[model samples]
Target chain A: MNILVLLRMVPDVVEELEIAPDGRTLDTEYLRMIVNESDDHALEQALILKERKGGKVTVLALDAPDVDDVLFSAVAKGADRVMKIEGGDGGVTTRAAAGMFAEIIRNEKDLQPFDIVLTGVQAIDDLDALVAPILSHRLGLPYLAIVTKVTPDATGKSVTAIREFAGGVRGEFDVPLPAVLGIQAAEKPPRYVPVAKVRAAMKTSKIESIGVPTMADGGQPLLDVSHMRKPVVSGHAQMLDGEPEDVSKKLAGIFTERGLL
Target chain B: MSGNIWIVAEQWRGKLSEITFESLALGREVADGLGVKLQAVLLGHDVQNLSTSLGMADSVIYVDHTELADPGASAQASALAQLVRQQKPRTVIVPLTNVSLGTGTLLGEQVGAPVVNFCKDLRAADGHIVADCVLYGGKIEATVTPRGDLTVIGLWPGSRPPDKGRSDRNPPVETQTVTFADQPSVKLRSYIEPDASDVDITQQDVLVAVGRGIQSQENVALAEELAASLGGAVCGSRPVIDQGWLPLSRQVGKSGLNVKPKLYLALGISGAPEHLEGMKDAPLIVAVNSDPDAPIFNVAHYGVVADAMDMIPTLKETVLALRG
Candidate 1:
């Protein structure tokens, strides 16, 4: 079985985030980059699945030369091949990114045997949580989001995922083979790649592109960012004094006033 | 007359959340800004009668049902779609809870609207509704204009101003309750609520989060003491949550609860995107991390480059003195 994981190279959230002078998007200069957090989990899940079924894992990223280090780094963690989707930033719209990514799975050479494609429920950058569904629709594959636990049957090619819904609700879903999933982080964590292994793999790994796909309508910039400033806060931090009993009562009153209880 | 902006009131066990009323207030302001009316769409079993007592904003689109408590997303969507057909509201506002997102997503699709999730600011633009959101790890601001005939926005926890909204449209004595022709497919199998002891940081107005600088698990006692002194909840980052130092409920981030408290004071916690996404909406963020370069300072209102170890005792003294 073959597995494909979508890896995104986003600006590190640590430094002060800024949009480019053009104001079309994130400013790349003076920024550190990291792999999407959930994609790590997706990679880790794929590696574990590979160990059991003896299939290969391929990670696809829409990135630049700088992202090649990350692609090779993923190899050290366990994936077999890393495919880069080349071109300048504006890769795909939120609505169509998943569809474009699904195309990567179909077009990759010798990787057609993949049985599953996994993603984080939402990339931290987008937060729209739209990729898995859009990909599922374009690929005609079943999908689920907010998955907390997964149990894959060794005898069968299906994996069961339990997801958290609203009002603290839970849903149990049985996803069959060849389905895509937006894995919640706790479903698994992506293990780190050893620097030594990354260096060795970089010597031989080929980072190629499948061309950057855009929105069908020449890709309208979905959104424009005007400002990046911290919100002003009102009111001071209120402190509650006294014993535990008194504190509880005070909190209960506050909760009643706030309608939380 | 203020053109009506209706908030679909969500109730359970006869109790309504101020969250609903808060959004209603924001809706009223939006209505006023557009020279329209403010209305509320109240849906629940025998809930139409409670509109006025619950701060009836404008008109109310109430749905009554005994089985409404079952919480099938399809049912809520069906009823909301009916309301959309009847009232043709310019914008429909809902909380970001799972119940709202599931049903809201479905309704937005059926209504041919855009459902903007976790919006931080809202306004009227180009004959439609627009919002400014803290997107991409709170690093970028997205000013989104909801597209389609009607717009749907998921309000973040603390984005709306509390007192900037009010309306005077008398709650009509009785309102119409529309029925959904097609019902939900998923049936309710008796809900088993999580234990009351579930770490419920979302319910707190104030949060004092501790981070990696605690050095050792025993040092967590300092945080506990601070939580006790401040009468606020104590939550941790993924490291602390994963280390079993705190329950998963006390975990704050994208995977955990997305909370926006009145005041969030960070004690020795480094600011990572995963952790920042959870609490970025906190209106008054104060960081006391020893490292001046900790990412927590980017969004913090006040930065204390001093050691949190020393600040905790001083903070306790400052607050305790104020309480007197």
Candidate 2:
């Protein structure tokens, strides 16, 4: 079985953002990048599936030439091979970056018309969470988003996966082989990246690079951000002076007065 | 087609959600600025007459069918894509629900256009719509131009104000029965809706929504108190339901009850477009978060940058006093 996981490298979400002097964009410097959080889970889920069923695992990402720290980490943890494509400077939107990655996947001759594919339900960076479906369409494969679990057959032909619907109802799908499944949070985080094997994986693993694809339809937001500064709601909120019950009542009253309750 | 703002008026299972009307309200804001006709594309199963409410549009286009009941990404995208190919509206606005997320992005890709996945800040100018949205767990806001060469945008639910009024003026948009595959990869053989005997938090006039910002299951009482003081119901984001902190019925998001209430107080909630899409129709939004950086403040009209825990105590008292 051949398994492909879409790994994205994004600016460390924890880092404070700096707005350029001009409000139109954010400054990319002082930003540290890492493998997307949910993609980490995607890789982990792929690793577990490989351990039980035994398939070659490939992790693909779009980033600058030097996203090797995170790519090496992916290898140390599980991936048999890591492919890094030069898709401009890293950390673009899901629309732009996924186009580049999809282009790379379509071009790769080594990958055995993948038996199954997986990605996080939503990447932490773009939060658009729309790519897996788009990728599924672009690849002409069926897609199921927010899949909680997957149970595959030995031949990698058919699989039954649990998907969450509205109101906690779990629906099981009898999906055919070679479908893309976007994984949500799983029962376990990917197994830790052991230090002993980390050095060897980094030394031996080859990071294959590729070219970026042009984005077709990036949407216009009616309102554009003047800057990428950290969110700031600057004002001292009035503390309602009272005890618990009284405070509760007072808060309700305040909202009512404002026609908000 | 060349100079009109495209509004995909969303209706599901015969009824239009409040966000549909709200989109028209926001759409007009774009239409007026672009100095073009307002076009509303209404999709639903047997919703032929539903387009009547969208009288404000210069043209109200209708695509109705019973198959739309099970609208999925591929089906809806193919239909909307056909409509786009024919009309070529300057911008397309879809409500930011899971189905919308799937279909809107798919259409964007099929047409090779940019789509604002979710945006609170949506405006149109110079034959283009520009949007700003938060990504990366509310860490940073990325500026997007929906009109950029080929980009179109999906509307962020709670960020835009609710509909105040719409025009009674009328001109019917030409109706077309879009021919796309209505095939759901996974067919819904039947829908076993939850027994309506159960009370849903979304129906209540007031909702005290607890987000991940709230610490533990035990701390839910702080939010419950506020709910009690206002004679309202309480709900939580997905994690709360996932953790068994609240009944799954209390979960609010794309997968849960969409609500439009008089008031919605988001506590300790970092507003994801998923959660916000469900409640953006609430007439008044107030948010409380310790981290001023939380994205909830973006759409919130009245917010206090403070710990929701401490603020809940004081706010509850304020509610009690006001109720008195």
Number of the top-ranking candidate, with lDDT as the measure: 2
lDDT tens digits by residue: candidate 1, B1-324:
122456666565566654576687677768778877767777777666667744546556667765475444446666787778766877777665434434554466456556666576677765557777656654456666654557666665445544443334457544566665551133333444434677578888778898777655776777777776667888887656544577656777744667888767788787765577578878767776666556677777666665667666656655555455
Name the regions of candidate 2 deviating beyond 4 angstroms: A12-15, A32-37, A44-56, A64-80, A124-129, A149-175, A187-261, B64-67, B134-151, B159-162, B165-173, B181-235, B239-247, B257-268, B276-290, B297-324
lDDT for residue A217 in candidate 1, whole number 0-100: 38
Lowest summed lDDT across 10 adjacent residues in model 2 chain A is found at: A215-224
DockQ of each: 0.15, 0.27
TM-score of chain B of each: 0.69, 0.77
Summing lDDT over every window of 10 consecutive residues in candidate 1 chain B, give the lowest-scoring window. B183-192
The sequence of per-residue lDDT tens digits that candidate 2 reaches over residues B39-153 is 8887777677777778767788887765566545566677788888887777877776544546667777677666666565667656667676766666666666543444556
